[model samples]
Target chain A: MSKSLSYSSITKKIVLSLAGLFLISFLVVHLLINMLILFDDNRELFNAAAHFMATNPLIQVFQYVLFFGFILHIVLGLIIQIQNWLARPVRYNRKGYSELSYFSKFMIHTGAIIFIFLIIHFANFFVIAKFGHIDPITYDSGNTYEDLGLLIIKLFEDGIYVIFYVISILLLGFHLDHGFQSAFQSLGINHSRYTPFIKTFGTLFSAVITLGFISIPLVIYFF
Target chain B: MDLTLKIWRQPSTDEKGKFVDYQVQDISADASFLEMLDVLNEQLVVNDEDPVAFDHDCREGICGACSLYINGRPHGPDKGITTCQMHMRRFKDGETIVIEPWRAKPFPVIKDLMVDRTAFDEIIRAGGYISVGTGGMPDANAIPIPKRDADIAMDAASCIGCGACVAACKNASAMLFVAAKVSQFAMLPQGKVEARERVQNMVSKMDELGFGNCSNTYACEAECPKEISVSHIARMNREFFSSKLISEKEK
Candidate 1:
């Protein structure tokens, strides 16, 4: 029993929605920067964007915010999942599972898988680029920075890792399928007219973003 | 119509229960669902066996008393109807039916297929009422409510306190039930005066009673006998927000 559980859970819903929406925006930004990999002769373009993201003062602050968003979303999701489990102490004898959509039924499952993927991804990329060893590259005259672009290309070149990335990205789609529309609904921004649009766009957004992320690994592996 | 029934039976609240299979024969296609249950109960009584216990009062979909999860949907397969209103014709002649009680921590089984839904009563007591003055009946048009508001209020007021929404919800959330009560009053001027405290009190009590928060799954509304819209939940969210906002401003 958490102390905060006594108050109205509306606060938790609002916070979860806000944090989730923030992370959603972060995904778009991340995809835009990561998309630069598809360009020709663009190690500089992608690396510079990555360097700016890592070192820019505003982005530096936002990096911490992004980390906080991840922590808050995961914690809130776990708490809500546990609360739901506790709420239904008994399971129905038959035919209950067919009632909920696959995405709705496995939200916690997808979220947990995404969390595990995030841990591995951050440790492999973010931590190394931040503190651990990465070979530095020098430009025209003076500037030298970690070659995160090269590290990413190298990581994605491995077929096993690429397969894992593809599967994880699809799992992220499952998470986003329910989460995007659900966030708006939780925050009380729903309407009869716009709700359908929101659901459609959320599905579209999740699918495109998933394919975009998966494209990076596939291109690096096969192309 | 012949049917195979898989029914849950529990002797008491603490005892473990299991699904017992029974074959019912020569059932009329037009018989109501509860009437079919009556036919089965009659057989049990004839054989000198204990009859299955279930709760029903009005038996006309008005009373929330009839609570049964039929074939994974609350109140049976048919939509916009309670257990009492569901008919045997909804199923195929040889179809097998699975029946169970509403399984949630707040709702415990008092007997086979009958759960103690006093949790809903507790929520209503929290703040689902307006304090009114004692007086003789006044003119109905005195308040001069707008047609739109009155219709919405009526729609919300139709909630029969059936735990179907709770039983149908994947999280076993009572959002539909509480939101209906909250909205029933939030729309009418009579309920507006206590809106702030009403939303706050009722939601807290719902949580304290172990009802899960709304995941917006919509299963509750899908299986609801009254067909109460999930929009009430969004409205309740707004009410809760304003409640917090106004009370904070007063401080």
Candidate 2:
């Protein structure tokens, strides 16, 4: 073998796809757990869910893995984009048209916005809940939980923040729209029998995850 | 019909290039894109000026020798056709056509609208072939390949190694071209003996040559004169992974 196949572009893509899929799975769990906020009128269910997520031993370990996945995906993505830019040093002066999908061309753009959103998200909720301060509430039965539900609702009360949150989530949807099926493609999982279905499923997944996350803030602020 | 041609004018590989405007009048709409260029060159030569440089052969489009980025497209504003197959009728009178060479790090512009695609030949040399033993001709029916697999292989075999896929790709990735070459062999039983090694070697060469990674944009498929599908890329990915796994196990 003249070269190590492990470091080839295909292998790099495979690693990227695996990490992206892992992050996607984490998104589902995060969205479902956050959905509890919508139905928790008494403010107990959402706080309980947050407490369980913070306290669960298995989840604690998985959270670290999830963090690693995000770092790997973001770093690898930037590296690929930079390499791609270098590949074509001179660009065409006249822009052309094809049947190419618009979202496919703008993944790096969408990903950058999502990265900024993540920083804000971590500072507003994760940092405060994890290391900073949040008032703890105690039930009559002697169970005490952080008042995360109130914190989230209070954050959503700001119209500007809510708008920014909604826009970022929408861009996340744009990212996922291409990424959901793209991950499978990178893994070489394409098939004539399953590809159409996977494409449809990817679009639906993007919409649901985007709307699901967006609904939380909108609902909290409105009613 | 009259047209304004803004063609790249580079004297040599190392020199800077720019689009130089030329005019051609009373051109037939039925003239092929290359023929229009031929007319422009003729006028330039008659005026004791340097003719515009480009690549063309087998004017029928099967040779994969002609390449041009015309009017912001790899092969003019046509679908499933090479630049040689593109007709002037596709453009209206007085249209401005921008023609440039394929731009990629591995494919440097040798001159105006002529890029050195020797990198592709280098990749082919790496492992784009299967070894065969010299012996008496075997019966055609000796190997029974599934009809579907054979058809797909035939589809993949149609790729002419043109760099349009690279020219059309946003990342300048050669995944489609490499995938088509890999699939043409991977689908046939006769080539299966070296399938694992072939994919690994070709991909390694491609990466070494500085081609970008596939972003799954499908622009390559859309612009391929052969219309090679991106599914072949998936198969190449599968082959690369399995090769790694099998090699690891053997060690």
Q: Score the docking of each candidate (DockQ).
A: 0.64, 0.76
TM-score of each: 0.96, 0.97
Contacts from the true interface found in each model, as a fraction, amount to 0.62, 0.80
Predicted structure with the largest DockQ when compared to the true one? 2
Model 1: how far residue A38 lies from native, Å: 1.4
Model 1: which residue pairs collide?
Answer: none
For candidate 1, write residues A1-223 as lDDT tens digits: 5666655677788788899999999999999999897884547778778888888999988888999999988888788888999999888776564344458778889888888999999899988888888787877746776778888999998889888889999999988988898888887777889989999999999999999998988988888
Give model 2's docking category: medium
For candidate 1, the per-residue lDDT at B96 reads: 95
| Candidate 2: tens digits of C-alpha lDDT, residues B1-251 | 99999889999999999988999999999999999999988999999999988999898989999999987789877889999999999999998888889989999998899999999999999888988889999899999999999999999999998899999998999999999999999999988998988999999999889999899988899999999999999999999998987674554
What docking class should model 1 receive?
medium
Q: Considering only the true interface residues, what is the Cα RMSD of candidate 1 after superposition?
A: 1.8
Residue B103 in model 2: lDDT: 87
A1-223 per-residue lDDT for model 2 (tens digits) = 2233337899888889999999989999899889988885757788889999999999899889999999989988887888799899988887656636568788899999999999999999899989998999986657789989989888899999999999999999989988888889999999988988998899999999999999999988888
